[model samples]
Target: MNKLSVKVKNLVIGGNSPIVVQTMCNTHTQDIEASIAQCKDMVAAGTQMIRLTTQGLDEVNALRVIKEQLHAAGIHIPLVADVHFNSDVAIAAAKVADKVRINPGNFAQVHKDAAVQFKKFLEICKENNTAVRIGLNHGSLGEEIVNKYGNTPLGMKEAVMQWLSMCKENDFYNVVVSLKASNTVVMTEAYRLLHNAMQEDGMLFPLHLGVTEAGNGDQGRIKSAVGIGALLKDGIGDTIRVSLTENPVNEIPAGHTIANFFESGENEILLDSVMAQIRRGSSKPEAIISVNSALCGNTDTRSQDAWNEFIIKASCLFGPLLLDKQIDDFDAVPNFSHAHNHDHECEHTNEHSSDHESNDAEEQIFVEMKKIFSADRLVEFKENLMQAARRKFTHPEYIACPGCGRTQYNLEQTFNEVKRRTAHMKGLKIAVMGCIVNGPGEMADADYGYVGQGGHKVTIYKGKTPVLKSVPEDQAINALIKIISES
Candidate 1:
């Protein structure tokens, strides 16, 4: 497939260019000063493209001022207007933003009406030379497509193809495409299907890669790496975003690590050594023990760089294996004498020493490993890897959007509270979303949703039905828990 390069301002995506790393602002777009400040910080953090939520004409107009100020300050990075459920705003934004992202599913309730709106949107974008990102996410596939294709990867591919066909019919080529999902398996499969279909059709659009609503911290990074890394390794991604439920600035480096891991051979060498050892089967435990010891031994997990490298390498190594079902789980010591007998207190030895005296070589290594990577942390890693791969759910699955300008409440704080309160609930898919426009639909298959509805209010939903409408912010979590408890 010959891929066309998309030009958003001076930055280019696809067509032999390096993978573009991008992020979106979490500040309210209407707050011109805050949005501009955030944009400058994003640029300083190495963001190639920054997207701001333009939920209406007001936000769109604010975006215009934001872009002008950014350019005036010589921050020439492209600004993308994120518009949903409002085609008129998108059309107006086409004149202002360097790029516009629209979810076709929410562009209109009716598919035909969406097509009509999108055609008009394309005309304006073409007139202004603005780029468009046909962003379609899983769990948000329109009813018509879901009924026919069952909300699967095929449905995601089919839905996007219709819009791509429309773009071709309208002769608009300045476009990129994305198919994101919080589930790594679903996300990877959707992109693969779309890539193959586009290859067969001979009109491939540049792909924007992301694992949407992946919660923050190590789990989020691992999940994004597993989904994005798999496709990137297969030569399928163009631009990438690591969506974390944290400060948007943090996404830049996380994204760079994933992109650079592929460019550099360091991670591949690490993975190959482990794979070879696993394949030998002669001393699998010895191989894993040695690798873990080398990687984590004498390593301070406190340093951001060290932690990032360790997690990224671990994700690259174990995430793909788990996702493909090649391995069920990972254990650093499977053949040790103390495998099932070791106590967390290290009762038989000094707890502070990595150089504890032990007759068994495996025991010595195991003790050292437990010191560096605690037993609890190792277990946590395994569980995180399993959940990220969609193989198991030892903890509550959180689908949280990296809050945007459209966000009304304190999303990160609210999501953390939600996780803290619901920590005991296992195997449940819960979503803590930021706003109503994309919240309900993007939460996808989450069994429960806590969606923010501006003015310091929230609506708790049980699988798309609002159980508590306009609940006060302070009482929202309690209400959500109450509903869940009742259910």
Candidate 2:
């Protein structure tokens, strides 16, 4: 980890400081009473910081009043003014608020001479001991940057990089940064690329992780969990805010849940393991084979219905998408196991065969064995048996996650479609995961990953990093086709 720390309103952030939990108030900032009430409510829910939208001078005035009210009432929460398209407002808010967030695109558009405006803005923030967050939203990058980088993750990182450079050039380092998207994969990868860029530049400004427009209810919670949790597991985020369509208070615990899970005393190793797995992308071949073989031949519990049970259990280990996207509950699995062990039959036939017609007998035994294992055994044969035995694969390995509350599309159907299209591309291990949260860590060994990023959107990845993002539901499959064809 790079050496860096930032101080905001008496609180230390970045480096080894505990991950901060934040949430933005949805109440209109101009409505002073409503703003104070909502912000207080959020603080009660454990939000360490609060962001309020300051669209213009009026909101700045409202922020000042809200700050006063909180102080008079004996509360000491740091206030952040979210300003876009208004450097004058940002300058004013910076004088009062603990932090002022400005969009690089908005600053460039609002001030004709952005260099002069940004210099003055930095001066005000520096003087007031106010921190700055050069917020970059994926859908809001400037036209020139878009033309150059194609509204992609690279474009998002470049937009922030330019501004970050400006701050450093002016000798201003009290900066936090955010590179966000509604799409989880894009958001996660952009943060990763930006983090690495900062590390190379020797700047470890704390990152604020979020997935914008994460809609309400259980859907919102799970989506935020997957994206935020994934990053936290890899030790990427410093502070986080769960962006939701509901009341701002609802977003607090979601962010806290992720922070809490990774920060748990016992889960420290789990987090480290996830990061290592993602970096290496695959484990030793011997290790994987040994585990699979042991799983396949569990002699400790061999019974009347052992073989089928073994196949089902092994399929569940890799995921049931191989056997067909159905239930995996052990109780519901029933007596799918077979009455006899097929491997012993081949050996017995070989031993009893007469010398005169040995080849024909062997052929007969082989055909019968194939017939016995052929039904409901396509997945177990290629993925389990052949893979464990280290033999040549007979089919392309398609790995996909069963859908969860966070999943946006019909994952089972999508997996089938992907397999139907790419079954001919043998010897490849491709993964399809429900969301970016698990895609990178879980599918580390896969050659490619097709992950759900947002509603009706997919992000295609070459291993752990994203290659294509925010492809529409209709075109994502085709985009995947292009990735495969090109690769």
Residue 222 CA displacement from its true place in model 2, Å: 1.7
TM-score of 1: 0.87
- Across 296-409, the per-residue lDDT of candidate 2 in tens digits comes to 234422232333333322222222111111221111111223433555533433343442156543233333333234334433333443332223365665555433334467
Give TM per candidate. Answer: 0.87, 0.58
Clashing pairs in 1: none
Q: Write the per-residue lDDT of candidate 1 for residues 1-487, one digit (tens) a residue.
A: 6789999999999998999999999998999999999889888888899999898899988998888888899788899999866888899999999999999777745445777888999999999999999999997788888999998999999999998999999999999999999889999999999999999999889999999999998888889988888888778899999999999999998898888777676556656656765687733322133223333335443346555555665676667777877677666333434443323423423432344334444456555544444446566776787789888888999999999887889999999999999999998999999988789988988999999999999999999888888999999999999999999
Residue 328 displacement in candidate 2 (angstroms): 15
- Please tell me which predicted candidate would have the highest lDDT against the true structure: 1
RMSD of each: 5.3, 15.6
Query: lDDT of model 2 at residue 301?
Result: 23
In candidate 2, list every pair of residues with a backbone clash. 308-337
Model 1 residue 326 CA deviation (Å) reads: 2.5
Candidate 1 lDDT score at position 86: 83
